[model samples]
Each structure stands twice: as structure tokens, then as C-alpha cells.
Target: MLLVLSEQEKTSFTFLTSLPEQVYPDLVKTALSQLLSTKQITKVVNSAAAKLKVEVASLTNSSLYVLSQCLLNSAKRNLTPEDLTSSLKACGVEVTIVTPLVISYTENRDILIDIITRSTVQAPEYRSMEWRLECQVGSRSLHNTVIPNVLTKWKISDPRFNNLKTKETYLNCDVNTLQHITESLRAAQLELDTLHARKMCRNLARIG
Candidate 1:
């Protein structure tokens, strides 16, 4: 799939294309390496400025940020090197400039994809639920009085943690409150099954 570039991204690509063709591999390598390690690209930018005898602001503003973003998005979407090259070319980048980027992508494809997959947020899932009915037959001041309540326990699991983390919650409510809670949950479930939600899921699937 072709990448759609914003106006600012177009400017970034233009800046990259204007640089000496020989610098392409090292520049793309620095960008991808720093990104893979979750480090800032400031050093690379500063070095590039010194080598090119240009202001750091020019490179920072027109290039590095967008370059990192492009690399991250490409990895996140698991784009093939050829697809990435085509997309960059479509953005007006020269074949020479695109070559290094594709090479970096090809070399680091597995690691990049693995990191992106691991970093994706997975929603907490229901594990178990227990509930009991409680009745209060009398109060200290009043005799012959009766009240009923529901006591509920819920457990949820979050997969993001190194260990499978679990959370527990306790709730006490009257019949009306319990009914309201049940109806609210049912409504939420219905919402998820709606056409709009299905469309959104499709869109997200395409993106990921």
C-alpha cells in the first residue's frame, strides 16, 4: 500500500532528497537504529548539520521528526521494502535516497515488526465473576424490616504486564442498581456489535 504524505511530510521528503546521495545509507541507518532503541535522533541531526554545514533547526524542522515517523509507521504496518520504496518514491524522494531506507527496513524488518507487535495495547479481559444475595432482616432501632442487596466480585486480566496481572473488584447494590448495571453492560455489548463498530474494527484491522 502507498503511504499518504501530509504537506509537512512532503517538505521532509524534499529535504532528504536534497542531501548528497552518498549520505543516504548512514542517515537512514542512524534514524532506524535510534528509533529501534527508542532513543532521540538529536545526535544524528547535529552530526548531519555539521557535515552539511547547515543550521540544526533546518534539519530538525524539515527532516528528522518526519523521517522517524515514516520509519515507525512503515514498520508498524509491516510494509515490505519494495512497497516502502514505492511509497517513498511516490512522495517525491529520489530512488537513491529511497535505496538506503529500503535497505535499512529490509535488514531490521523482523525486529521492527516484533517490537511493534509487543507494544500494541491489548484490552483487559474478563476472567471470572461471583455474586451473592444478602438480606438484612432487621435494624437496631426498627424490628420487622427487611432489605435485600447483591454482592458481586469481578476479576479481570491485563496481558501487558510481564506477569499476567489480574484485578479484582467488589460491588454491593440493591436490585434496581443491579438491574441498571446489567442493562448498561448489555447496551455496551450491543454497541460493540453495531455496524459502525464493525466498520471501525475493519479500519483498525487495515491500519494494523
Candidate 2:
């Protein structure tokens, strides 16, 4: 069945869906559960070598995955699923999700370690720092960061984030509530990015 959603809803859905279940299988379920503590989301814990490697580097490696929705809807870009997906891989971010999607995390001993061993980062800092998102979707280690400010801005809630609702409102977030927070974040961030881009354009125009 087709589901109707706000631009943000769709954006968050696509991003969370593409991520590895190991990190946030119960993303929807857990988002409902106090929005996944920011503390848990930011640091990797009790993970094997592979899971540890991937989650640590999610931001730089998977900008497209994280930004695909915003780029498509807010920036009015015509990025295809393949395009964004490929861009993510090319950037060295890992992505995986099993069928019959889970709302909570499960054991994933089978999660490939090939990506972790074979992946190459261009810089020392990128090599050491991790890239895990709250949801543990596609992740990567960046050789050189091109967008630090924008990257920080992209990360809204938590690494364990399948949803972005504040916790005071509910014990765990439901799909309905998840959708609400996603839209709110998207609207605010898209506008911020648009303005940031516009100012850069104006500055360039003046320089020329």
C-alpha cells in the first residue's frame, strides 16, 4: 500500500530504510522509545569490529543517503535512488537492511566485514574517527571533510535515531509521530541550507 507523507517524512523514511538493521533495527520502535538517547547514538558500544567501524564513519561516508530527501525535495534536485545509493557507495559509506523490516535491533553476526577491511579513507583523522548514525545505516570514514558545518547541521536527533521527536512528549515514538518530527526537522534544516547556499552564491557573484 502506498503511504502519503510530507517531504520530511519521505526523506527520513528513505534514509532509515537504507541503513543496516544491526544499528537500528527497531528504529521505528526505538524512536518511539524516548527517541534513542543521544549518548547511545553518538558512541558505538558492545559492537564487533565491523559494526564498530561502519557506524563510526556514517556522516562523511553517507552524506547522500542522509541528504537525499533534502536534496530531492528541498534543493529540488532530481537525484535517483540509484544515483544517491551509488554516490554513497562511491563515497565509501556502507548500507544494508534485511527484509520484513524490524522495529528493534537484532543480532547481525553476518554483517559483512569486507567493507570495513577494504574501505580506504584519504586522511588520518578520517581513518581513526567512526561514522555511525543513530540508526546505523550506511556509514563511511571520510578522507577529507568538505562540509563540517553542514554535516553537523544534518545530524539532528541521535545516532540511534529512526525518528526525531523530543522525549518529553512520549515514551516511544510511533510511525505517525516519527513522521511528524521528520517533517519538522526537514523544514527547518532545508531553509537553513537554502539560505546558506544563497549567501555563498551572492558572495561569489560579488567576487566576480
Candidate 3:
């Protein structure tokens, strides 16, 4: 008989199939829960590390595993993952995660430490600073910014402002909600990247 699996079921089965089964249900459940959390940490670490623009492929898995534990610890301490340099030191990752070549690529632990520092997004200081948005249509330009705790009707400097449009920028959302919005943006970017890759593959096949 053939087995049918949904995408989620396939993913779960692939992960679990490699592990040894235990007789105790509670132990299995706890292990699976930790595994899921670790997976999430790996995802966050990898995305954050990409901001460093380094060839980190060699230490990718090891670095993610070590960094994920620090991330979890940061949550317990109510600290930002942006405290990455200290967290890496606390985790003793500097000694284990890097080789001579990895060190040379990053030029030292200070640069490697930047992987987390650059990746983690801190709460926006909208009160002290506003984010700018600029647009141009046929040489007509428009510019505006979102200010914190301000609900004033902001007008663009250029006449083209009326023609240009943008999705609702969640200026009113709390910092936590803003972080969720960033995560959603990352997911959307990944989806677009996958779509573009598939389109390129199809075009290449046609050209061949």
C-alpha cells in the first residue's frame, strides 16, 4: 500500500523518522517540543546571520545550534538577541563554532559577532527618529515619514503624492506587533524569491 502525506505531515515524518522511538510518551513529546524550538531558533539565526554578508556555509549548522540556545536564554532573561556578542561568549561558541578558515573569512570573532548584532531588529525609536519613504514619478518626487505618537495628516512635498500609494504602514502598532510585521515581510520575501527561482528555471529549460 502507498502512503499519502500532506506537506506538514511529510515534514514531521522526515524529522521524526531519523530519531529513535522511546517507550515513554511524555519523553518523546518533550524531545519533539525542544526539537521544534531548536528548528525555529536555527531559522532566526540563519536569517540574522545573512545580514553579515559572509561566507558562513561551513559553520552554518554549528553556529545556528549554538546561537539558538543563546536566543532561548535571552528570552528567559528578557534581553534582546542583539546582545549577541556577549551571548556568543556566554555560550562558548567562539571556541567551537569557528575554524581557522572561518576566522579568516570573518577577519576575527568581532566580525563574526556582528552576525547576531546586525540580524536582530531592535524596537524602532520613532519618537527620536522617523523612517523616510521616497517616491518619484516622471521626475516628480514625493517624500514623507512616519512619526511616533503623532496622528497628524502628513502631506508629501511633491504633487505626485496623490498618484503614489502604499500599503498601511502600521505606525500605531506596539513594538511587539512591529516585530511580527517584520517577520511577515521576511516570509513574503522568501515566497517571492522562490517564485522568481522557479520562473528562471522554466525560462532556462525553454532556452535549452
Q: What tens-digit string does per-residue lDDT give for candidate 3 at 1-208? A: 1112234433433333232333122222222234343343444334434544433452243333323333333333344323434443343333332122122323333433454445555432222224443323233353463333322223333222332432223244444565687899999778767978789877664322
TM-scores, each model vs. reference: 0.63, 0.20, 0.18
**Model 1 residue 159 CA deviation in Å:** 3.4
Model 1: per-residue Cα lDDT at residue 53: 77
Candidate 3 — what's its lDDT? 0.37
Lowest lDDT 10-residue stretch of candidate 1: 155-164
How many backbone overlaps does candidate 1 show? 0
Tens-digit lDDT track for model 1 on 1-208? 7666678788787877777878777777766766677667677778888998778987666666676677778888778887898888887877887777788778888888787778877777888999999999998997998888999998988666632899888989898988898999999999999999999998776555
What residue runs in model 1 are displaced by over 4 Å at the alpha carbon? 1-3, 37-44, 89-92, 113-123, 127-146, 160-170, 173-208
Rank order by TM-score, top first? Answer: 1, 2, 3
191 Cα displacement, candidate 2 (Å): 24
Off by over 4 Å in 3: 1-170, 195-208
List clash counts for every candidate, in order: 0, 21, 0
Q: For model 2, how big is the CA root-mean-square deviation?
A: 25.6
